[model samples]
Target: MAPPKPTAAAMADPSPWRSPAQRGRDRALKREAVLKAAARLFNEKGFHATSLDDVARQLNVTKPTLYHYFRSKDDVLFECCRMGLEMIEAAAATVPGSQASGLERLRALMEQYAEAMTMDFGMSISRTPDTALSPENRAELRRLKAQIDRALRGVIQSGIEDGSIAPCDVRTAAFAIAGALNAIAHWYKPDGPLAPAEIARQTADFLIQGLAPRTSERRQPKR
Candidate 1:
């Protein structure tokens, strides 16, 4: 038998338009693509040196197309930094849920943090200076960074309490770990001698050595 005739409604409008939910998802994806491209450009060339046109050219789109996704170059940079911090925070969050010893968990988190440093968004965080951001954006980034620091400190405190990590100042240790990881963004290049994973592994191992448990006489008082 022949197929039944199409409905009049379907014939008039065959639903070519995306539904609201699909439209929202598409918009989000496009925005993310824009952010990723902007982040890479910002990392390759200093944030001040990279413009919206540069990002648009990299994406093979018009600068006006970027304005649809981001307000301006400053806004794009802020969003890139925000994305980077979120990635680091997400990596750190995994440690609290793991059953590993405090030191092991800390190492895992550090490795993740190092891996993120090699990504475009993550690199953008360290590459962009606070002075480049608007005052409001600068304050917001500092707040997020403080939150990340607290998370790192919490892990250090746990390691110390469990006696898996050397007894020392949590505040100072967290500062050092974060500083080292952030610095990775500065010197790391895709063409670097070591792969990102190898770099991360080596970096984490080096950092963890300082936190390794020590003899009672060797351990310093936990502060």
Candidate 2:
């Protein structure tokens, strides 16, 4: 006798069927993959030198597949910069509500920022300049950048007021700390001797140390 035919449902259903949530998650994952690939290429080749085709080829996807997630190369770069800014902002947000001392909170925030910079999104932010983006994007990026800087400055100010950190020029200190942390994206390598976590710890330690009150200075608190 001939074998029975497959059920209509079985025949129609696709292999590796996904639920609605799963499908949404899959799309999110694919979009992130595109962004990461684009970031890496943009960092290595510079934004102008890297094209959509390069990103697509790097991800083994067609240009149209990229279009499904991003409208253009500029869009991808904008998202990359936005991702970096969001990461820093998220880290900064934790500082205000934490029970830890202001200095401790600042240390945590700095470490978090360093780790973000070590990632692809942060690397793209560091490598790509504001001028590389559209005027609107450039303005948004500058606004986000200023937000992060202001947050850092606020933390420093709090630390000083609370006596957890030494008195210093808050603006200059914020700039110095940010400049150091942002530079990590330029030189950090996944295969480098120091891991991201270790780099974060070390960088935080160095930055925090500068803000530490000297024993002599601590004896006489700033009025």
Candidate 3:
């Protein structure tokens, strides 16, 4: 007997099936959507309170569908945290090519950082408890956190050397600036009176004031 004939669906061949590259792209897009939805839920409701079910419902999918992309709720939370950290890292990356004074460069990065905090993924960075993630994830998170810490300190160091910023303890100044920026995530409300850009600009400016060169240090006008 001849082999069974292809069904109409199978006969469609390339039309009915995606190529490997297309399938990969499709999966990535879907995974990103899942992460974004989960991150928003994590920000609105605490990590412990926001279940995978909530995330699935947010995307109008089944809970099992989420498993296709993530190992578990903790995996989703960890990825959200990673996404937040990576965003801040990307903001820092923007500063290296600049010719601006160190203080100016620092302020630019801080503004981006502040704006990131108001976003869903960035808010997850602070809102999700590090202890809730697996030991491995916590380690990875710490590593990423350390990179951000180094970036902050590098700018402060440059500012002091260039005289654009006051001579101060780099560690202490970086800590103060980062602390203030992190607080923005906690109190930020999308519907608040201040827009994210305004908040970013204001918060960055206020912090930079402390780091700016003191009046006595500025070059005096010619007599």
Candidate 4:
């Protein structure tokens, strides 16, 4: 026997099929999940020791599932490294129009950087070696590294000029600050006693104190 005709409401309602844009968004979200899973594994076990299987297992998916998003482990590592660099770049981008003084801006940058380092992607960036990436990727990572260094130095110089920070070698101070902030990735634990915010605050306070003007300098007459 023939089936009954559909009701008006059923005919008017659209199918549950996802649109192209919705599918694209779903793909993007899945890819980001892969990246985060990979980063966490890479952070826990060094990049060389972490495999696609490990990442997929962490995400409760098969290794082939990762292939749907990334070409290989190297691709995932490169992306994570790029993400870490982008985080620093993003924080640096905010310095120019910040209402705070140069030193305050620098402190803010340090806090942002510290927070990033404690994250999965940033920790992966800290532990992964440049040699693990292809030559081209290595070169790009180096370029970004240099850019971050320059940004830090520029902030220090601005602080020096604004009289918010004590006079010191900008290059030396930048290296010192960056090194300290980057080191957090090596020791920070998600379950540790100190929260990310507290760690960031303490790190920024300690680093900024080194650049703070001395009492004598603070009392000096304006030039």
Candidate 5:
């Protein structure tokens, strides 16, 4: 008798993202390339003006093939937005683990957030004209955006607790930071006068001053 079929967990394991590692890698690379091409086309020609055909043409593929990876153009756009927010979340998560003070960590996180926004993929979401994105995609994009906001708030809260950041309404502070960082995605560029690192540093410097410990004393009090 043939060996028993693999269980769902077993099949899912070892990277269900790909069974053939090489094929998986190639697919991922292609997916990224297509997304990049789509972003470029969409940015240059507003989402309403750009279509799957446009993206496929840029990548030398067919619309059906594009659909195989992305259900629709909105799907692609959603992916781009999701990517930006996810990057922020991932980067912010790294800050608390660093040896830097909470304020320093917040700065670093903001800087990293700016750097991430400067990336082509990230910029595409913010700069690209997507007036045509279905309400569903737009809503999803906004929802994922909240995730970024929440992650940033957590960082701010950590700063508050550590006395590295001045006490403030966490929601307001977090939203402000999120808005500022998100805006960077709209205007930042790789060829801009300032490098991503420099911009990030400057942003960090400014925010740190405002956020750094105010009382110069510990919360528990000295014996």
Candidate 6:
């Protein structure tokens, strides 16, 4: 038997579909729709429970249409991971020059990060499950995650070097601080008692002071 014929809409303006700029914008809009639908489905139903068919239904599109934008559920999950990683990097970059300390930069960065994670279009860094993706996708996510961690580590190392932060292993300290900040994205509620900025500020205060060197502890005399 012969294969079915392509519809006029599917075959129409094949050249237009070939235009990079036009194709890019169209792909982006369609992708955005796909991600939004996936995120809602993933959140409403756990990641494993949601399928590509459910996502297609949410967008009122066919399976092939969704596949044109995302090859598989793994592909969509990777997009979410990519987006959350970008937000963390973007938030870290938003720190101001006048922040005055490594700790301050960490704090300022976290403040903005909390808000970015809850933007309603995608998953926050905390809630994103990197393990659900294919090994290749997970590796890509690890690369992006490393980038964000390095940025925060730079600021934390600077603080430690400048005496603004207590002398400590910058890598360990930075990871702890970054982890604390990103965790807010998991449970932070806009309608809850603390707003994003407030949660950020409070988190910063705890981390900054909590991590600072204690000058009051009695020092043991060098043997």
- Residue 123 deviation, candidate 4, in Å? 0.9
- Against the reference, the lDDT scores of all candidates come to 0.90, 0.90, 0.90, 0.89, 0.76, 0.74
lDDT (tens digit, per residue) of candidate 4 on 35-137: 9888888888889998898898898999998899989888899999899989988999876554678899898899999999999888877788789998888
What is the TM-score ranking, best to worst?
A: 1, 3, 4, 2, 6, 5
lDDT of 3 by residue, 9-88 (tens): 88774767888999999999999999999988888879999999999999999999999999999889899899999999
Q: After superposing candidate 1 on the true structure, give the runs of residues whose Cα lies further than 4 Å from its correct spot.
A: 1-5, 11-13, 96-98, 216-223
Task: Write down the worst ten-residue block by lDDT for model 1.
Answer: 93-102
Q: Which candidate do you rate higher for lDDT, 2 or 5? A: 2
Q: For candidate 4, which ten residues in a row score worst on lDDT? A: 93-102
- lDDT string for model 1 (17-115, tens) is 999999999999999999998888888888888888899999899999998887888899999999899999999887755467789888888999999
Better of 2 and 6 by TM-score: 2
Q: Give stretches of model 6 more than 4 Å off.
A: 1-23, 120-124, 213-223
Error of 4 at 102 (Å): 1.2
Clashing residue pairs found in predicted model 1: none
The candidate 3 region of ten consecutive residues with least summed lDDT is 214-223
lDDT, residue 39, model 1: 89
TM-scores for candidates 1 onward, in order: 0.90, 0.85, 0.89, 0.88, 0.77, 0.78
Regions of model 2 farther than 4 Å from truth = 1-23, 96-98, 217-223
What is the clash count for each candidate, in the order shown? 0, 0, 0, 0, 0, 0
> Considering summed lDDT, which 10 consecutive residues are worst modelled in model 2?
93-102
lDDT (Cα, tens digit) per residue for candidate 2, span 86-153: 99899998764646778988999999999999998888888888798989888999999999998999
